[model samples]
Target: MKLLSFRVKKSHLLLVGILLVAANLRAPFTSLAPLLDAIRLDFSLSAVQAGLIQTLPLLAFALFSPLAGSIAVKYGIERVIFAALLLIAAGIGYRSYGGLFGVYGGTVLIGLGIAMGNVLLPSLLKRDFPQRVASMTGLYALIMGVGAALGSAAVVPLSQLSALGWNGALFAMLLFPLLAMAIWFPQLSHGAARLAIAGEPQQRSGSVWRAALAWQVTLFLGLNSLIYYVVVAWLPSILRYQGFSAEQAGSLHGVLQLATAVPGLFTGHLLARMKDQRAIAVTVSLLAAAGLLGLLALPAFATLWVVLFGIGAGSTIILGLAFIGLRSGTPAQAAALSGMAQCVGYLLAVGGPPGVGLLYDATHSWHGPLLICAALALVMALVGYLAGRDRCLTPAEPLNEGRLSEEER
Candidate 1:
């Protein structure tokens, strides 16, 4: 009885630790946009250069994500996660205090850490709680959304603190990862045993890369991400152009982020009940399209537009993460698919903000860029519908000697 009780307690603690880790993943990056102008002024950076700060992280995700699964295969997922948390903490410290080198170098560290966490978390969840993938994914998404919203919401206030300023504001975010690390430390001791219990299959399949459904999932994730980062990078500027104050714009940005999280509360149940997720996908895309249309046609209703867009963007992310698990038959495959999707997905996303800027620069108006994004939302609806289909990426057969096929690689 004591042993069973102890196991239950440990399970609860592990769940809490996973959620805490999720919370740390996004806040550090999302928190920065509100402070971008301040950082720019302090650093004497051009708009392109300031934009680079945002893009750099995505680039790191693109570069590092494909490698994350292999690293986990060799090092064990728990150790990789622990290393990632340390990297994030160290990166935050460097970025906030290290001057020019700190800015770029720290961003690289933070981005790589986030990329590893992002790739590993889905696999970890799928491995430990096979029956609860959607529920757990939704919970993680909900926490992540809250964390991002909090990060965005807090930046202005933190920066405003007389003694702390921008540097201190960025530095303050370090606490999240530190806290997560503390919670996660206990899990590391049993990492090998945990992997064994999860039945890490020896048969590796190289088939994910060749699967059509995998591409659909990848595109769904990529397009959704592209729309999100584009908005993240430019929404404040758009609001400002419509005559809102900087503070108002920043607050709205935070609100937008918060709205994205609202769906997380319900997505798990929704996903679990409906394997064919096309309706949800189409609905969210339309909401986003309507929001973007509102921005162009009725700038006065900025609040409504942002709220709608946020819901659409946030729901898509939930679906994207859920798809990574729902479509895979094994945890390793989930990790491989996740790594592939994020690698290509983020690579596609790296151009978004800069592209938005170039379009705005060329036309000298928000109308052109807004229209393009609205149309892309429609495209997302189409692609997401395809990805929403219930199917696995490959047959459930394990590969001989647990080796991935050269073609799949």
Candidate 2:
């Protein structure tokens, strides 16, 4: 019966809205990656400042994510989502204008908007699509990858147009959040129902922060974010140093993101059937690590390396998101876990881009930075092993219950 409820067709529109929201989450950030050098030159910014711009969103995610659920609880998730979309739209629009203030300020807004969506979307999925958490997460995650690809790919071409330039190219991204807002508006009509559907009173326990399992999940997520964002922020620069043109680098970055979407197609079902995800976790970790090693040793085969990294990173993302659902006993627990993981996880992630840039600046080569990433990938694998254990975070409970626990599976 619960499964059938999750399969109902009436909620299709809501699912579209959810995917659309996911789409907006990454486009605003990834669009800037391809143009980082251009923005840096135009603003006369230092390497550290450029990295700081890239780090702003992660910082926002860390600072604002915990508050998103509380705000949703008070204002309703749908209303909060509506506001977040507006915030993204406004931020992107303002950011299109050239200046340091416009850049940093708009980024802050975009980051804050995305942070709320980040914390709320998983909770929304768990609450409304309890039986379909993995599949639904995969679907949204796939859309996110697509949006990222489109953003990274299009920005280069769009900037070439005489009328658009980088500013217009950036302003063009506002279409996503604006379109998401249009689709999301109807959800606000059922605010009370959405509030009830998105969280449960009994599961609203504060115990997730203390659970060892939860910390493992949080570290897994944080390490993944650190690796992924470092790649996003600096991959183009690394490729450029390897002799790829800006357009070619951007195109390759797009390919990397497109590669990420592939695993989302089947990983959900795979995760659903697995008793424990440790094997899957280890495989992705090794794949990404190998890719990093390839980039450092054989820049000639950059495409292959990028694709491998993308697959591992993308698949791990689906697993990380699925863990939030798989490890929790209820929707509210999922929300709390999401908030806890993302807040602490993203806080740790804030160091990735800037750290890489700093390392590069100090050593004057990509070797040191790439080596650092490779090391982190190994750490990520260890964290993934812990997070992948078949256990459940019982509501209001500080300890993990059991392997393939009934409450979780």
Candidate 3:
């Protein structure tokens, strides 16, 4: 009954491909994070220019996000994903070996590829394996986290290998996407038609863009991301300035991502027990602030500080996702809120790297940037409280009432 084509269990191949793509979602960026200064130094990139390297992918993700879902609808998810893998591979290869054009161009492609994968994979999971959506989605998230951690950790070591410098290390990642493409290629012809999800018209009874609760959730998600990515893009350099060696800083960067993935293990249990998540939100945001301040005030304990920051950053990432579901009253509202939050949230993240870079460039000191993000972390705490209030995006229906969506059923 579960037979797919040619003795394949249909879902098995699909699951493999989906998981492969999930692992790739954050790997490309995390791999490059610790190597950012190397890239900057090699190209003589100004601080702001180096920041753009980090920002470009986020910018591209934001700009392309709204369109990816629709594009997948028309062309088919499998085909889009197939192409996305290709882009990611090409991006990595180009970014590693080529000149400036290759650098920025490659990042854009990676972003586009990641955007499609991030946007569509969950829907694909729901469509193909509705019964296992929750578990599959959790696995998907875990894979992304672990993949990112590995990428962050592995790059410096790989780059240190003779005849395979930073660019070579980046290029080595091509093997993953290439392998994924091979794993996924077998289904390219069979899937687009057989697994196609039926399309639905975009529904907006009231635009989530206009809702106050929507803005609160949006700001919370946005600010948290801004702080998180600032850390991702700059933590290594920040630590290095404090006299940690490249290897040590790189290891800690990996730790940050690994810690992020840890939250998934406990998130389900914690959320189930909480009546509302306001306290949770404030706690995480404060954790982030404390860690940031610790970085400045307690430089000797950088390891503890980074772990705290990592936990706080990781928690906020989950909180952002949870708020999307917790605050929406209807499925349609959730859909709209999701689109709005992600688009706006990533847009906010797009500015964080370069903005911090600009500060660093101006002041020639890390203290100002660290202090600024710490202050923003406090702001995230305030927004988290408002966003976490026990309220719906709109009173479309009551969340616990188990009402159907506003769209025609």
Query: Given candidate 3, what's the lDDT at residue 108?
Result: 91
Whole-model Cα lDDT of every candidate shown, in order: 0.86, 0.84, 0.76
Candidate 1's residue-wise lDDT over 315-358, tens digit each?
A: 88898999899888878888888988899889988988888999
Off by over 4 Å in 1: 161-163, 196-206, 242-248, 395-409
lDDT of 2 by residue, 300-322 (tens): 99999999999998898898988
Who is ahead in TM-score, 2 or 3? 2
What is candidate 1's local distance difference test score? 0.86
Arrange candidates by TM-score, descending.
1, 2, 3
TM-score of 1: 0.91
| lDDT top scorer | 1
- The number of clashing residue pairs in each candidate reads 4, 0, 0
Candidate 3 deviant stretches above 4 angstroms: 1-13, 34-50, 96-99, 125-138, 160-167, 185-198, 203-206, 236-251, 272-276, 325-336, 360-368, 385-409
Better of 1 and 2 by TM-score: 1
